[model samples]
Structures are given as structure tokens and as C-alpha cells.
Target: MRETSQLPAPGSGAFVFTAQEIRELDADLARRDLLELTMEHAGARVAEVIHARFPTGPVLALAGGGANGGDTFVAARHLHALGREVYVLAQGTRHELAGRMRRRLEGLCPIELLTEERLCAGLSKTRVVLDGLLGTGFVPPLREELTQWIRRINEAGKTVVSLDLPTGLPSDTAGDGSDAERVRADLTLALVGFKPGLLFSEVGEVQVLDLGVPPALLERHAHASCITPEEVRALLPRRVRGAHKGTAGRVYVLGGRPGYTGAPSLTAYGALRAGSGLVALYSRAELPRHPVESMAHRIEDWNALTALPRPDAVALGMGLGEDSVPVARRVLSWKVPVVLDADALQSELRGAGHDAVVWTPHPGEAARLLGIGTGDITRDPFAAARALQLAYGGTVVLKGGPSVIATPGALRVCLAGNPGMATGGSGDVLSGVIAALLGAGLSAPEAAIAGVYLHAAAGDRAYARLGYGLIASDIAHEVAPAWHVLHQASSEIL
Candidate 1:
């Protein structure tokens, strides 16, 4: 693992907004006395980001006719003032603050009305293109001219900096098209803050540009935060010199009948590796090798599981087959904080309200839990995660290409995992990691957030070394190294 935080804090405030949500935030902020000032602040921040990223360069600003275009113009003016050869390419009518910026930019730099021919010709000479043609409100099936321009710009392969969001990508949801159709930026400056769409793979190298939105102001408007590596590092359970087996954490992993012994063992191994001092696995006829650090106990039924001492954290359902429903019910009834996953979530929502329960489900399981189709869950994972959280009354980890963690008032997205983590036992391992955190005294939300981030970070590390061949076991083994990176990051900060 790398010995540093790959993802630094974007800002003190982190939230992923839908287009509508962003508009709402803007409206709420606009109601305050700082509307025009906010726009000005936004433009100034864009300029600052541009200058810091590529100082002293021949830069091209593709200005649209909206607020995003205004931001682009402001950046161009700033660059021009700093003695950089800045060019502004405008294609549409300038309106609102954009109109004001257009007049200002015309005084500072030549605002060229772009033809496709001119744009293609100009692209070869520019070092970087500030893409402000389309912003957060843009949707797919772009206009003919815009699409052609994006394609040409992408083909030209110049360093592109997008303002707010990449063109042709939906800000409200994940992009579902090939990269060719989307604006592939080298850097994306998220104005005011980032949204979920900006974190999409197509929107590369995101950095938050605070538009004078105070932390407290954002707190009033924002309901979600992008999980950061630094935050996860701080949330990890501290280790002491004389900490005993009981002091760290005790995690009980239960599941893995006949054909699925590996699942439970994987869960136990994950918990143990994630700083759990003692991990006990209760499996039905487990003969195959389990992690040596974890104690494996043979169990016939739920009665046998109940007979064992109540562990600090319980990981229920890896591969328990048909018995998962009863085991889940019996386990939840005991009032232990449980990380319920896989077959454990296969059953309908039941049992009295437990103090802490986390449901780790992929789209399929999430769909099943909500009685909706998997397509519905995949299409809007945020909504699905929220729905699952409301229905089941706990933190919901909606596992997907990018997992969404839904707690009561906040939703956090884990942008760490790759396609390499799509193997069978991956979710099982995640269940263990979360359980261990719960055992270590993190709140349900904190544990889910930290665990999801850690699991994805480990997968990313494993993928860096092993590529797509990374299996679930690789993810499990990489957990220790992942935590090491976090530890190294914390030490460096101190």
C-alpha cells in the first residue's frame, strides 16, 4: 500500500448533490444576501484553481452561456491578467452573470465565436482547455455541435479542466455511457463543492472549489459527504502498547454451511486482519483451513450459536443457505450490533427494532430488500440506499461499482473500489470489516463509512499490484496493508 493519503480532504465540507439538490442549495444560499457575491466568489475560485494547476500557459476557455460559462470567463480573465495567453471560445448567447462575464472577458481577451473548424484548428496550439460548455444541469444526447466539439477536444488529447461537471454526463446519477461520448477531463474543478456525478470515472482528478459557501452554510444545505481517506484514518480504532485480546475487539462471524465454508472463514480472516483482537467463527462442519488467528467452532444450529458468549460485534450470513432467515432473526433478537449481509439479507425485514444493524447488500440484494427490481436500484443507488435505510432502520451499504453508505441524515459514497472487487467473497469480507469496526466501538454509521472506505481502498491496492485478477482473498490479505497506509498517513500528519 502507498504510505500516504491518496485522497486528501476536498474541503472541510464534502457532499454529493443531485442537480436538483444543487439548485435547491443555490436557491437557499441565494435567499441570503450573498447571491451576486457567491457567483463572484465562484469565478474567483475557478481562476485560482486554474492558475495553481497550470501556471503560465496558453490556456483555452470553452465558455458556454450559463453560470458555468461565467466561471470560465472569470478564469480566463484572471489568466490573461497574469500575462498568460488566454483564449475564450464562445458558442451561444451569454445570459445572466454569464453576460456580465462575457463583456468583461471581451475587454481582457478576444472572445472568439467558435465554429467547429475554428475549434479544431485552435485545439492543436492550446496547452489546456477549460471546459465550461456544459455544467451540472447537462444531460445525455448532447446537441450536434456540442457533441462534435467534445469529440474533437477528446481526440485532440489536450489537458482539459472541466468546470463543475463533464459535458453530456448526468449530475443526478452515474454516467452510463462509453467514455467516447463523455467529456474526458484531466482535471475537474467542482464549483462550490462536488456532486456524485463529478466522482464518476469520466470526471477525472476532482478538486473542490469552495464558492464562499461557509462550512456552516453547507451544513445547513448539504445532506451527504464524500468519504475521505484522512477521515477514515482518524476513525480507525487506536491501538495501545499493552492492549490485550479483549481490549482491541471481539468479533463473532457466523455462517458457511457445507459448500460455503470459505465464506465464513473469509469473514473471520477479514475481521482479524482489520484489528479485531479475537475473531471466532461459528460454522457448520468447517474442515477446510480457516485463518489461524481466528478460532473456528463447529455449530449445528442457531441454538448452538446462541450458546456462545455474546461477542462485541456479530457478522451474520456469508453462506448459511436456507438457515439464514432463522439465524438472522435469532441473532437480531439478541440485541447485538450485527453486520447482516448476503443470505442474511435474503429474508424479509422482521424482528423488533435493534439498536444497531448494518445491511451490506449489492444491487440485487438491495432490490430484494426493497421489493424492487435490481435495475431500479442500479439506476438510482442513492435513492435505493436511502429507501433501504428507512425500511430496515439501520445504516445501508449499497454495494456497487461505487458503494453508497446511507446513515440517518447523511449519505457517503465510497469512490475507492474498482471492478476488480466484483468477485464472490468480496461482500463477505466487507461484512467482517464492518463488524470489526462495530466491535471496536464506532457508531453504526462510522463503522459503515470506515469499513466501506477501507474495503474499497484495499481492493484498489490489490488491483494496483494484481490488476483484474484480484480475487476476494486478495482483498482480504490487502486489508492490513491498507490500514498501514492509513497509519502511515496519520503519523505523517502528527
Candidate 2:
């Protein structure tokens, strides 16, 4: 198998556009007489990626009767020029194609009309399939004939590379609960900008390609931005040589009942590992030892929080259990930089008016807070995170396969985590990391972004060594190394 090339991190100003916005930009470029050039760039990039990634392979290009097909025809021509055996499967007859698409089709080798038998034959002979059957204009509830073809292509098991997006998937929303069948591509070449639908798992690995659209056009229509390592590096808190325990910021973790002590301990570990000067755990019951670097305190009442020395930041609600509602209320009233996770995410606490708060909730917890089903949260995490932020009046981190961090003005997606990070207590570690960053004086959004990146990067590092067997503790232990790597990279850049 050919090794996948590492996609360069998008610039900090990179923004994601909707399908309609992309179309508008396309029309705008067309008026400027740059549309054809953009299409050529897209085709060249697709062919070049296929040539580099698939190396020696017979490529079968599936073309529909649209601009998407035009791109496919151009790619097929380029692939043939590169000496690769290529086949073109056109969805319609040459007479059905129009204008640019028709001209592009005439440039290709004799194209075969798309049919079940021909598709099967093409699949059998090809090592890579380019899916140009649908682009960003696709809608849900795909036609039965197209669904059948998609199913066949998926079953064919060829390394399918989609031109813009997989066929049958809409551009507006992520997969959500749609019953429509879509082509499962191994890679998707996002033309010009990313669509929200590409954020899901079904789209596989995404590589955004520039289609020569001016950056200003994309920024004007962009709905959200992606989180990159470079952005996280810039957000990371810096420490001076003179910094000591008193100067490094203190984090107070308040959670952990009798049976769920592990959660609070992991949070403390995460805070300590993420560079908090001191971490103290205040739990309902304390019968066991915690991290050596962290102090443990047993709290009998909510009022105990009032007496405790004010820390720079606080992380609450990990395994706090059913009785945590009162404690959460008291803590929210403090108005210090706080990260609310797990049991602390109470509906009654919505809009608690904390000046600086970060809520880290998985889909289920987020649904509970929003009074909706978990499916709604999964369908469009961007909207869910935004809703959470609006309701709670703070930064919201909607944790998932690719987590969404929503601030007042921006929606950011973190794509660094892995399946191994889905283990229990993983979110507790994230909460602690965020709290640590907040304690170190970063804004809620800055801390959440940097912490989410650090936590995910650590999980990725642990996965490299321990594979699926890696646990939450492994991720916590890897935080220092992840931070060191990012810090080193940032230093080199400087």
C-alpha cells in the first residue's frame, strides 16, 4: 500500500464554505474569466494526487453529466498523459453533455456509457476509482439507481478517491441520521474549501485543494474555520524561566464520589501534565491516594468551596454523581475561569453567567443540556456547539470524533484525535487540560483550543505506542511529550 502524504496544515485564516457559497464563488470567478482555469487546476491536482498516491494503477473515472463530470474528464486526460491506464464511465451519452463538459469529454478516450455490467467490469480492472458523479450540489435521499451504483462501488473495495465529496452525501450537513446511501471513498479531494459534511467519518481522509478562488471570496462566505497545529502553537501559554509554583497558576478540581475516584485523579493528572503549577483535588470522599504532585481535600458541604483558597482556575463535574447539582451551582457562582464536564453539565446551570467558562460535553451530555436527542448533536456538531455556547454564554467544546469548539464569534473543529481516545475518562483529561490552560491565564476559547489540541495530540502519540490497548492514563502521561513537541515546533518557527 502506498503511504498517504501528510496534508499541510491550513493557514490560520482558512475558512470552510457551504456548497451554495462555493457555487457563488464559482460564478463570481466565471464572471472574472477564471472559472475554466480553476477547473483545470482542480483536475490537475486530482490527477497529480492520484498519480502520487496510487502510483502504479489502472484508474476508472466515474463521470456524471455536470461540471463534476468535466473535472473527471480533465483528470482522466491528465492521468492518460501520465501513462496510467484509464477508463471513462460517463453517466450520459455525449449528446446529453453540454458546453464545457462536452468539450472536456471530447478530449478524453472513447467514453463508455455507465451501466451495471460496465461498472462491474471497470471495477474489476481498476485499482483506483475517481468518483466525480456528485459534487457539493448533492442533496439527500439519493436516486435509487445512483444508490445501487454507490453500493456496488463500495463493495468493489477499490481505493475510491472522490473529486469533491463522496456521491450521495450532501454538502450542508455532516452525515447525521440520513438514510441515504453514499459512496465510501478512501480519500476526498475537497475543491477550494472544506464542506461541513466532510467532517464526518464516512468522507474518510480529506485533502483540501485550491481551485484558484481568491482567499477574500472564501473568507467572505466562510461559516467556520478549522483548528491547525500552528494555531494551537500560537495559543499555547508561554512560561518564563523565573516562573515558580506560585506563578505557574493553580488548578482546583472538584469531583469524584466514593466509587468514582479515578475520574478526579485523571483530571488532576491531566492538569499537572499540561503544565499547571499546582493541582488540588476536592472530592466528596477521599479514602485513596492521588497523584503525588496533587493535593487532595475532602469536602463535606458546598460552602467548603467558599472557604477554600481561590485558585486561578477550576475544573468541576467529573464523576460528581447525582448530588453534584448544588455543588455545581456554588462553583458557577464563583465566576472564575472554569471548565464544566461530565455530571457538572446540568440543564439548570445553563446561562449561569460565568464570565469565563468552558463546557466540555460529549453528544449525550450536550443533548441533555439542549433538551434534544443525541442524534441531533451528532448530525451537526457545529450547530450543537454554537447552540450550547449561546445557551450557556461561554465557550463550548462539543466533544466527538472530530470535536467542535464554539466561541462567541467563531466555530472551530479539532481533527487530531483518534478512536483510541474514545475510552472512558478521556474527556476528564481534556477538562483538566483546559482548566490548566485557563489557570495559566489564557482566554476560555484559547485554552480550550490549545488544550483540545494537546489532549488529542497526546492521545495520538499514545496510540502510536500502545495501539488500541492504550488507556486514559496513557493519554494523560503523554501530554507532556505532546506539549514538548508543539513547543519545539513553535520555537523552531520563531
Candidate 3:
């Protein structure tokens, strides 16, 4: 919720780690007593959420054999102790879970073998379906049976909560990969560290559960910008009594051709409202919208591009069209950090040689940039974002439903926001925030990290006021308040 412009780009929002990397982080946390403690904490957290929502609802814990399943047992035991009806469906044999995990679930609740018929019947009346069947160990393209079960759970409209990564979904961030299946959850609770799968996939509302993992350890393990409010607010500069318009940061937005001027205008407004001291729109003479506090300077020729103004950051590609192609080609040559968005997406975002950039592409635009169709990129946001990051040589912010921000080097998740943010023009506002942050000097990935959360948090605030009627402009207006609120919370913790 912190003002993203005030902070450096967040670490990667990918929860995914390579197999070897996963083993290392898990082992490290496990060695320090976090293995048992974190799971226990996660389970308890889920139990608390469920109990509060469906306090008296019969709980059916569909558990598997790994650590993910172990968390279910922990939660089931807690629920049972509180006198709630809890049933444990051991999807696999008892031997499947070994060591302390097995020991913890033993005799705590009624255990039953989850045969297809029994599973169906149990799911039929279950108030809360706790999916601990498969956690981070799950790979893509689930087996037929598991896929069927996931579908059933989805259509049944149960308040299904997945522990860690959703069952049937890949534990890695790539999501669905070559695998043809994924679990559609009502909620996914991330523990220890968030997985990239949740942020980019069809997984439901994600909630970051307390795993009791030490801040130091989590920070050490973090490769993405899953930073806390405190960390984000630390980046905001102190507004000394003596301040000038030129002191804050200068952002130059380019990429509006003859017809599409509103896009660039909106981006400029978003930056101005976001507290940028100076923002100039360096688009075709056609797009002339400007912030109320400032006026936009229009550029006509290519030679005037570099001569306009010395900007800290540049934003291009909003409402551009065929003519934008020639202009975008020239714009990319700029040395400053840039956010390639809207129509210029395909032309400007080449795979990987960028010095610093935040590429914003909708599914279709993403497809154009990657040389594929929209369906392919929409099918897997996590992978697409990563692909873009590697290809563009900078961070990629795959905008719209299940948005993802990826830095070529880091992996993390934005554990904020809601579903009420799918409105049009939202991407333009986001580009503005990101550009302003870059202008303020956060790295490419850092700007994206902050932008994702800022955009979502602003939407979350708008939801509180307008509900479904919210628009992109509303979200832009809400950013200032959200920033203050989040910043205040950060100040209190210190």
C-alpha cells in the first residue's frame, strides 16, 4: 500500500524457485526449526480464518503426503481441539507422510481413505474444503482423477482454501507449464514465502498467512520483492520544508500518435497525482492532454525527442496505432529507463537488451511482443511475465487479471489487492505510477514491484467507495490516500 513511486521496485513477485533452489530454502528454514513452526503457524492461521467464517461448518481436510498435507493436519488438529467437526481424508496411504508430520496427525481426528465415492460424498456437504492434498510439490498437467476433482470442487461453489500452492497447480511460478491443469481455489494462503503461481494463475484471492518465519530469514531467502509495508515506506524521501517543483522527479511520457491521446494523458495525470514534481508528455503533437497542475509539451519531429527535457524516466505506448511503429522505434533508442506499454508493446519490447525497463502488456499486446497469440500468454501469466523479463532484458508487468511483475533476476509475489481492479485504462494509470517511480530512481524491477501493489491497493480503496462502479480514474485518485494510510501503518510499527 505504500506509494510505489516512493519506493524502489519490489523484488520479484514469483514464489517459484528452481528444484534445487527450493530444496535449499526449505532445508534452511527447516534446519532452523522453521519447518515445523512455520507449517504449524500456517495451519493455525487457516484454521482461524475458516473458523471465523464458517465457525460451525463441518471441516473436511483433504490431505496428501507432503509438507502441504502436513499443514492440513496441523489445521485439522486445531479445529478439532476447538470442538469443530473435522474430517481428515488421507488421499494417500498413511505411510505417505513420514517423520514428525505423520506423528502430528495421528489420532487427532477421524481419518478415512479418500476413495472416489467417499471423496465425492464428503465434498458434497463439506462447508470448508481444505486442500492440503498437494502443495508446492505439485507439477503441471495433473492426472485425470485429480483434474476431475479440481473441476468438481470448482463447480460445487465450496469455500475451498488451498494451502501454499493450490493442489494440481505447479509449485513453481511458471504455472500450468506444459501441464494442462490447475486448481481453481476460493482462496490460497501463502506461507513462509509466497509462490509465484498464486499471483499469475487462476488461484483465488491470495492471503499471506503468518508462518512465524523470522524476518531476517525470509529476507535472506527472498529473491523477489515480497516486501512488507515497512520496507516499501523506507524508500519515500523526506519532503523537507524547502522543496521545489523540480526537486521531486521528472517523468517524460511518449507514445501517443494522432488518434490515441487519452492514453498518454491519463498516464501523465497518474504521475502528477502520484506526487511527481514534474511530468512532461513527449508524444506526437496529436496527444495534448496534461495534468491540471502541469501542461504537456508536445513533440513533432524525431530530432526534438532528445531535446524536449532531461527526464529521469520515460513512459511510452498508450493509445498508439500503426503510425506509432515508426515513432516507437525511435523512442526505444532513449537511454533512460522506460516503460513500454499499449500499442508500442510489440515494436519497442525486444527480448533482452534493455538497460532498465518496465514493460506493460495486456494479454493481446503480450502476445504481440512474444510473437504468439493472446490465448497462449493469457493461459499462463507467470510464465509469460518471466518470458517477457528474459526477452526484454528488464522487468515485465503483465497487466490485467492476475497481473504479474517480473524481474529477470528476482522472484516474489505481491500479496495485496483484490479482483475489483479489471477496469479499462487501469494499465495507463499503472504505467504512470511505474514511470514516476523510475523517474524517482528505483530500478526497473523495483518500480514494477511497487507499481503492482500501488495499482492494486488503489483499486482496493476505490472498491471500498464505489464497489463495481469503480473506474481507472477513481483508482488513480485513491492512490494518494492509500499511500498515506500504508505509510502511517509503517510508521507505527517502527
Candidate 4:
């Protein structure tokens, strides 16, 4: 396979549009021959994915009575032509498009009544399930029968693939508002646009399928986006033929107190592994066991720390404790790009130089920064990230399940990380990665985006190898592999 990023390029990713925006795009397309064309293309794409993934399987297609059902019927028709046994459980509507497709399926395959008894009867024989029960227009508090079917589908333990959005998740928002239940899929295939719910919620690995929507139409409407490895490949700095350490970038890490000596070392290690030529760790307390890859320096006082030669970028506040405030204040005057994390956010921040800083805060730290509750931040992460950026005047990374990266006019979310990365020291590693990228010549926003993406991608790779027992250092080690993968893709593309 060609080593391109998972998502296609131009922007290197799709613009995640809200449900209303998608509807507006649909209406505009419906004015032409585009709506039917989109449905045909969507069905073909879903069929192609299913064929490639589960080639010779007795498949079950759970379809609704609207356009979603029509898409399912199309896939079923394609599967039947491939000589696979395709069973469809469809309910309700006799809508025109759906009706036409169902008639086609009747001639080619089996169409069963969507009842609990029939569903349970078919579960044992089916290997894969396609969820097309609801589209983006679905609301919460699903019908009791539908809920029962969803529960049965879940209990079957079959690999479920959902089209568009999952059955019950709201297309516009990340949080499931009511106590309504939804289908939990092993793979969710989103068509046309990206939705925050699909990226943030329990819907498993998601891939944005091209519905053949014109790039011009997408460009006219899309704003928010997700970052891909190809974009990072294009953005990462390269080592020239005769490059030396001095030409490559210097990253300074300032943190680590009495008992927290490991934080600074991890920060320096992350920067070094992320491709910084020279990484130096300066700590208030002596860390005799600092990583051999980085040079260790002593910080007797604020004056000693600032007296050192200027670095291309600085990573601050890994474990400075209460001394973080003074250390961060001193560095603010240095006028270098800085990545502030952990206790560094505790420092009182103000003034014009805020634009040079990249703040990485968990919800609790974000709550502290905005003087709001953590609940509010989790309810709407995009808003919280934007608020933090506007308040601080730089890039803000709101670290959570699906970390949100916000700058002045842009927002991007990374969907690669897993629950294992919630361990301590991960944020410090992220800070170091951002600082290293900044030192290597990317702008503050670009560094934040690339850093967050690479950090998460590394965590994903580590998770695949070691599972949930992953510690912070494991992710740091994987950064090199992640960088290699991204760089390799770039080289092949060029």
C-alpha cells in the first residue's frame, strides 16, 4: 500500500460539519442531480469497505425506512452479486427511494421482517452486521421496539458496522443528552462529513468515506477539521544533507522539584525523541538520573536559569510545584515559543506575549484557567478550548478523551488515542513534543496540531503493543516510530 495518511489530502482531512450544515448541503445538492448521485456513491463506498474487510461472510443488514435504508439496500444488492448470503431486517417506511431499492433486493436476496424473533434467529448464522437503522436526523428516546433490537444486536457479539452516524448519537453534539441507548459498533463509517459525536463517543474506529461530494462544495462550507499523518509529514522539518546539531533545534525543559525528578527527564526525553537535536533539562532540584540523551543543568535560582544561552523553544511546568509561577514568569520575558503544562498554568498569565505560548491543560486545569467547573468544560470541549485560547491569546490543547486543539480561528480534534494514555507524565511528553516542533520551525498553531496528533498516534501504537498497562515512557518511546511512519509516508509521496 502507498504510505499516505489515513485521511486524504488537500487539507489532508475532512471538514467536520454540523448536522444542519450537512442538511443545507443536501438541499443545495438536491436542487441538482447530486442527491441521488450522493446516495449511489455512499452505498457503493460502504459496499466496497464491507467487501474488502469481511469478504466471504453471511452478512446481516439492519435498515430503516428512509434514505439510510436505501443505502443499505444498495449494499445488499452489491453483496448478493458477489455471491454472499445477505439478509436484511427492515422496518417502517415505504419511502420512494427506499421502496425502489427494497424491490431490487427482493429480486436478488432475502428481505425479512425486522422483528426481535427473526433477529435472534438470524444472529447465530451472521458474521457481520451493518447498522443503517437511523441517520443524522434521529432524536433520542428511541422507540421501545427499536431499543430492544439494538440491545439484541449488542448482545449478539457480532462485529457491527454503522453507516453515517451511530443509531442514537446526535449528529451535532458530542454528549448523548438523554439516557437513551445507542448501538455500539466495532467500526463506524461516516459518509460525506465528520461529526464530533462519531469522533468523540464510543463508536469505534471511524473512517470518513468520500460520498463524491465535490471539493469545491466542501471548501465552501467546512471549517473544523481532524489532523492526519500526511499533513504532519508535510509539516515536519527535515534534516538536510549536511545538517548538524546546531542547525537542528534546541529545546529547553524547565521543571522537576524534590520528589518529582522524573518529570523533567521525561520532558527532555520526549523532546529529544521527537527529533530535537539538543534537549537540556534544568531543574530546581538536582536530578542525577536524567536521561543520557539530554544534558542536565542545575537551576540555583531564576537568574541562573535565565542566564543560559537562548533555546529555540522551551517546555515549562512539568513538575515545578509552587516555584512554577516564578519560573514561568521569567521565561515569559524570554520571547521564545513556550509550551506550558502542569503547574505552569498556575502562574498568573497576562499581556501581549501570550500569543507565543501553547497551553496544554486537562479539564481540571482548564477549569482553573477559566474559573469554571470541569463539568462545563466536558459538556462542550470545543467551546472550552476556544474560550481558553481567546482568554490566553494563543493555542490551547484541551486534553481529554478526544483532545481538542484550538487556536485563534481554527479547531482540530485528534481521535487516535486510547484510555491507556490517561496516566501521569503523558501531558509532559506532549508538552515536550510541542516545544520540539516549535523549535524546529513550525508556527505555534502548527506545532500544537502536529504535536497533539503525533502524541496520540504514538499512544495508539504503544497501546497496540502493550495494551492498557501502558505508562508514560512507553508512549514517549513510540514517538520515534510514529515519526518514522509519518516521515516515510512523506518520502514516498514526494
lDDT of each: 0.80, 0.83, 0.69, 0.81
Q: Model 2 segments beyond 4 Å from truth?
A: 1-15, 93-98, 176-180, 490-494
| Candidate 3 residue lDDT tens string, 247-280 | 7778877756676677788788778766678887
Pick by TM-score: 1 or 4, better one = 1
Tens-place lDDT per residue, model 2, 243-327, is: 9997888999999999899999999989999999999999888828579899998878767678887899999999899866787
Kindly give the number of clashing pairs for every candidate.
Answer: 0, 0, 19, 0
Model 2 compared with the native: what TM-score?
A: 0.92
Runs in model 4 deviating more than 4 A are 1-15, 55-59, 80-87, 94-128, 173-180, 239-244, 293-295, 303-309, 350-353, 373-380, 415-420, 460-470, 488-494
| Weakest 10 consecutive residues of candidate 3 by summed lDDT | 1-10
Model 3's C-alpha root-mean-square deviation from the true structure amounts to 5.2
What lDDT tens digits, residue by residue, belong to model 4 across residues 444-486? 8999988998898898888889877899888999999988878
In candidate 2, residue 8 scores what lDDT?
28
Candidate 1 residue-wise lDDT, 1-494, digit = tens: 11122233422336666777777777787788676677777777777777887876688889877777877877788778778898888867646767877777787788889789878877988998888898876766788888898899899988888888877677776677467677888777777666766554445677777776777767666647778778888899997889899988899988888877889888887898788989988878673878988888887666877567888999988888778887888888878889998888864654433658999999998888888898778767888889888878878899986788899877888767787788889988999999999999898999999999889889988988998789988898899899887878744452
Question: What's model 2's lDDT at 416?
Answer: 72
lDDT (Cα, 0-100) at 72 in candidate 2:
87
Top-lDDT candidate index: 2
Indicate the residue-level lDDT of 451 in model 2.
91
Which lDDT value does model 1 have at 217? 65
Q: By TM-score, highest first, what's the ranking?
A: 2, 1, 4, 3
